[model samples]
Target: MEKQRNVLQVNGLNVAVKSAQGMLPLVQNLQFELKPGKILGLVGESGSGKTITSMALLQLLNQKTMNVEGSIQLHGRELNGLKEKEMRGIRGKDIGFIMQNPMNAFTPVYTIGNQFVETIRIHTKLSKKQAIDLAIASLEKMNLQEPSKIMKMYPFQLSGGMLQRVMIAISMCLRPSVVIADEPTTALDVTTQLQVLRELDRLRTECGTAILLISHDLGVISELADEVAVMQKGRIVEKADVYRLFDHPQHDYTKKLLQARPVLSVNEELSKLVI
Candidate 1:
């Protein structure tokens, strides 16, 4: 079998913001490759530039305020300096995004089904009837109950968790080759968080989505990431396989992060007893 091409690659990426306050560097010398169906978790605290790195890949950061350098290639093609119209096509057609807050993304004016159908029509060459059917099917895939009712309700009418399910459904409908999930499940409580994250993992397994998952939660990273990139003050201090990073963290900062995270998993439970 032929080796699969990488879905996304970033090399020596630098992102900086300019303001009256001064030029503040966000991300520097960041490099990573995301293969098809694998998830690389960008783990860091706030102000560490995890979200800035994600924005740089698609050129989504405000051009007037932020300047970015280095190569961000998708499937062997360089994305740097791509026109906005070109990037728009790639944003949803080839790469999907699940934002941190569903409310921030979900339009309150449109019914869920209408918005979903619109998304399907925009990304896919499908008739209105076909789009509606596809939208409903996507909702079902998210394991949502009363899918029909959800399809008809507006964003404000649904709960946070329900709205999140709708957002996930929208992102997964076309099975974009790359998915950028930026703190997607952080708004939920523990039980709902598990449900959402597990569903995200399931989607990756089924759809071959190469994910750039951003989250400060180590427990969440342990559950979903194949690889981990530890970020601090705009740079990745360590990048390693998940198991190795957890078992033998080479950097002091990485080890401190691991130590700070509360023990939550069965593996950690066993380790506690062994210790």
Candidate 2:
């Protein structure tokens, strides 16, 4: 079989913000790629520049106050300087966003059905009824019982877990070639988080969707990432396969992160945590 090329390429990336005092670098010299049917984990704690990287790739930045330098190529096309109108076409249709908090991206005034239909209509040639049917079907795949009721309900009516699934469904409705899932499971309960991850795994396998999975949770990365990139202080400190990264981390930060994961069994936990 012929090898598929990179769907997203980021190189020489730098992001900085301007304040009253001076310039502050948020992400420095970051570089990576995502091929079809693979997941690249962007792992780091809060304010470590993980979210900034994704926004940079999609050209979603406040250009007036920020200084961004880099090349972000999606399907062989550069995205660095595209106009907002030009970027809009690609944002949802070619590249989907599963935000850390789904509610942050959702509108309080609209029903789930309204938002879903609007999203579908933006990227595809679909009528109101067509989009509505697709939305209901997508909700069903999330294992939501009485999916129709959820569709009629407003954003405030649903739990965080439910909203997360809705965001996933909305993002994938266009079958985007790449999905930027930023802390997608952060707000969910443990069991719900597992379910969401499993659903994402299924989506990746079944549809060959390229994923940029960003989170502070190493356990989440261990469960889904094909390759891991460890970030610290706005730069990638080390990167390796999940198992190798866990067993033999090169950087002190990476090593410290591994040490923080709780052991599963009580005996193992006791042994590892012995005073």
Candidate 3:
């Protein structure tokens, strides 16, 4: 088999916040690589620094009070010290992000189509009509019905699942090299969750987009991630291929996480756990 190239690499990543006491470390000495067309699952409990890590990669953290140290390389370009303008060009173009809350990703007042066209126009030189066409095409890729109709509806008028799918469509419309999906399926029903997961998998297969998927659900990780990193207390204790991580987890926290879920038969596929 051919080796896949690394689209994103993080080395010696540490995130700290200033408080009255002193600097409080949220993520410590994190290191990982995201390969093209593969999903890397970052699994951890709440407050384990999964979200902060992703934010740091995008340089989305506030520089005023937060201290981020180490290297974040996208396509071998260092991004830690880039200016906000430079980072803006990288974001949505080279690196797309899907936030945990779909509603928070968009302006409540704007129609979904308007936002989509604006986003595409910002990243590309496409005209308004061309951008709208692309947006509708991308939404159709998510299996969303009446893509044109979805564009006219305001965020509040759409269901949570619909909004989540639209968020994915927007993030992917640019066909970014790396996509940071932070809990993309959180708060959604089982069917919606499955649809979202399938869309993510399709992105990997169809577009060869590397995905850094952060989720608390082991089942979700098992279904989508090629490799899994088990994090606890802001540190990754174990890292392995998805099958190895599930069948032979090395860390106690990983073991406990598996035990916390319902029992599965030895012969069952990891995807079966989702249903």
Indicate which candidate wins on lDDT. 3
* lDDT (C-alpha, whole model) for all candidates: 0.89, 0.90, 0.94
- Provide TM-scores for the models: 0.93, 0.94, 0.94
Q: What is the lDDT of residue 191 in candidate 1?
A: 80
The whole-model C-alpha lDDT of candidate 1 against the native structure comes to: 0.89
Q: Which 10-residue span in candidate 2 carries the lowest summed lDDT? A: 261-270
**Residue pairs with clashing backbones, model 1:** none
Higher-lDDT candidate among 1 and 2?
2
lDDT for residue 239 in candidate 1, whole number 0-100: 98
RMSD in angstroms between candidate 1 and the native structure over all alpha carbons = 3.2
Q: How many backbone clashes does candidate 1 have?
A: 0
> Over all chains combined, what TM-score does candidate 1 have?
0.93
Give RMSD (Å) of candidate 3 vs. truth.
Answer: 3.9
Q: Which stretches of candidate 1 lie over 4 Å from their true place?
A: 264-275
Candidates 2 and 3 compared by lDDT, better number: 3
